[model samples]
Target chain A: MTTVPRRDRPGFYYPKPPATWWLRRPNYVLFMLRELSSVFIAIFLVLLLVQIHQLSQGPAAYAAFVERLRSPGWIAFHVVALAFALYHSITWFNLTAVVQVVRLGERQVPPRLVAAANFLLWGVVSLVILFFFLLGG
Target chain B: MSTRKTSEPFWWGLFSVGGVVAAFLVPVHLFLHGLAVPLGWIPVSPARIQALVGHPLIKLYLFVLIALPLYHWAHRFRFILEDVGLHALRAPIAVLSYGSAVVGTVLTLWVLLR
Candidate 1:
């Protein structure tokens, strides 16, 4: 009788499933969420493009587009899309610190720091834009 | 083993720049769509949009804001897929992401110029 290697043996002793297909990894769930958010991003882009096209056409066309956006159905769509986009943005920003190869002379900067900085910078920029728009000019 | 940096420079550059742009642009986007409109401060009108985009400085800013961030987001997304061991899909995803950004840039430039 041929004996299989201990590591290769399929039994309860294995840390993971013998086959990749049988594993339900947490990373898989994350990947799905990230990819699913792309659909929302696409939808948002289409809406923006349509608005841009209308803006180019003249006042009446633009007005019609805006009116359409104000409809309850469209507003609901925007709300859902915004939720997805926000989730995507937050997740992606957090991942940035991990994937980028950042090194210091001796001590490496923490990934959490990078993520925090990103969020802080965003907050500041948003405030600045809001200030400008609200204060006039 | 090949020592050359496997990552594409254009894509990396886009990602870096896009990260910075997105950091700023996203907040502005939220404020514009979320706060301003809700507060009844700025009406969504063609004249308002034209005035916003028509200013030379604002036009330049918008171009950078829209193009760079999209490119950045796409590149990051491709990397996320790669990290998940979806290596087989890498090439196709990279091409699609970069191609879309290029097309978006062209369209945006056309709008700004016209």
Candidate 2:
């Protein structure tokens, strides 16, 4: 007598399905965060353009624009957007080393070095800007 | 050996050039807005802004700074998305980024001219 293999049998090959989407795949969460941060960049540009328009109009319009930016609602918007921008900056900087290729003969520069350089450059730029601002130049 | 072409050179070139330009322009921008005008160091008149923007040299500088940074940013963002496993969306992302850069440059030029 030939025995038929059980179609409903569950063994090591396939025991049970994943409990949830998160359990099945975890990277999607980070992907969503990164993509969502792009919205802040768009928002920032719009804010800047509006400010430029106000400046072009005249002093009164510019003053109104500045006042609007200082409002609670705008402040809150900027705070949230700033957080997103920080996240974007961190992630983007981390990727810089990976994307850039530097080779000295057969030896390649490390990615960490690239990332470090980028951060350092940012620091220097910030300092210069601060200096110029403080010096009233 | 089948040689694989690497994108590293292009990326490095872009970042290097951008880094240098940013190092210079950012300070000038900050000074103009923060110290020069706000602190009453260099005078905070609207006429100053108009004059600065009207200068041919300053206008050219602004154009380069705006256009190059936009291009660099768009390229970087496109690659970042691709690296994160969104290969299918690369075409659309590239189009959107480059298109926005071009539009932005045109708009900025119009504003400056007016």
Candidate 3:
């Protein structure tokens, strides 16, 4: 159960891929981009935490934070972050079909249907958030 | 080469759950908070958002939204570091990445509840 795949094993040729291997193939490029997406998302969450902390500091502080957020630099950062976030969502849902196998009695649901269900749920969740943001007053 | 009990599964579970959260929830938030509201496209009164953030349910949502994806980032960033030729330093990388996530989680709780 504890098999180690270390180099220098007898009769084994361990190939260490170069750092740029991910750049070689289009899928590899996208795969690397997908992994990189979380970093951006994490960065956004940290910004959210800063915004929340500003809110805790009271109205003026929160307003200051909002003003800073409205600056062109922050807006541009967000435009990029939104792009990465969308890529994350699309790739994540696409992979869910492969990872989640839904079963209905004796029949297993098709992978496309599973992914489609996830997309439907994704849309509904998005709409709910939009509602809370725009019209939940 | 140190024989440590692997905590891989625990981290992996968090990664998967965090991935789900990021995929399902991150875009709308990013779009609204990062772009729309900030750009003044969707008018939001400061007091309304203030009240919303103070609500217990919204606090819970914020905690989930901000904290879990951090773990996902930690896990993936660990692999990314290894991929980028830091394989020898993976143990330290794992500690650093996941430790930051833990710190982020604690800070999230403090900000939300305090």
| Candidates in order, interface RMSD in Å | 4.7, 6.9, 1.1
lDDT of 3 by residue, A1-137 (tens): 11225553555444567778898899999999999999999999999999989987888998889899998999999999989999998889889888888899999999898889889999999999899678854
The best-first sequence of candidates by DockQ reads: 3, 1, 2
Off by over 4 Å in 3: A1-13, B1-5
> Model 2: which residue pairs collide?
none
Question: TM-score of every model?
Answer: 0.69, 0.59, 0.92
- Give the TM-score of candidate 3 (chain A): 0.87
> Which regions of candidate 1 are displaced past 4 Å?
A1-23, A97-114, A135-137, B2-7, B34-45, B76-93
DockQ winner among the candidates?
3
Please rank every candidate by lDDT, starting with the best. Answer: 3, 1, 2
Q: On DockQ, who's better, 2 or 3?
A: 3
* Model 3 chain A lDDT-worst window of ten: A1-10
* All candidates: TM-score of chain A: 0.71, 0.73, 0.87
In every candidate, what fraction of the native interface contacts is reproduced? Answer: 0.17, 0.03, 0.76
lDDT of 1 by residue, A1-137 (tens): 22232333344242222323313778766666665565555445546656666777988887777767767786676677666667766876788778765678877788888888777876787788776655442
Q: Is 1 or 2 the stronger prediction by TM-score? A: 1
Worst 10 residues of 3 chain B by lDDT: B82-91
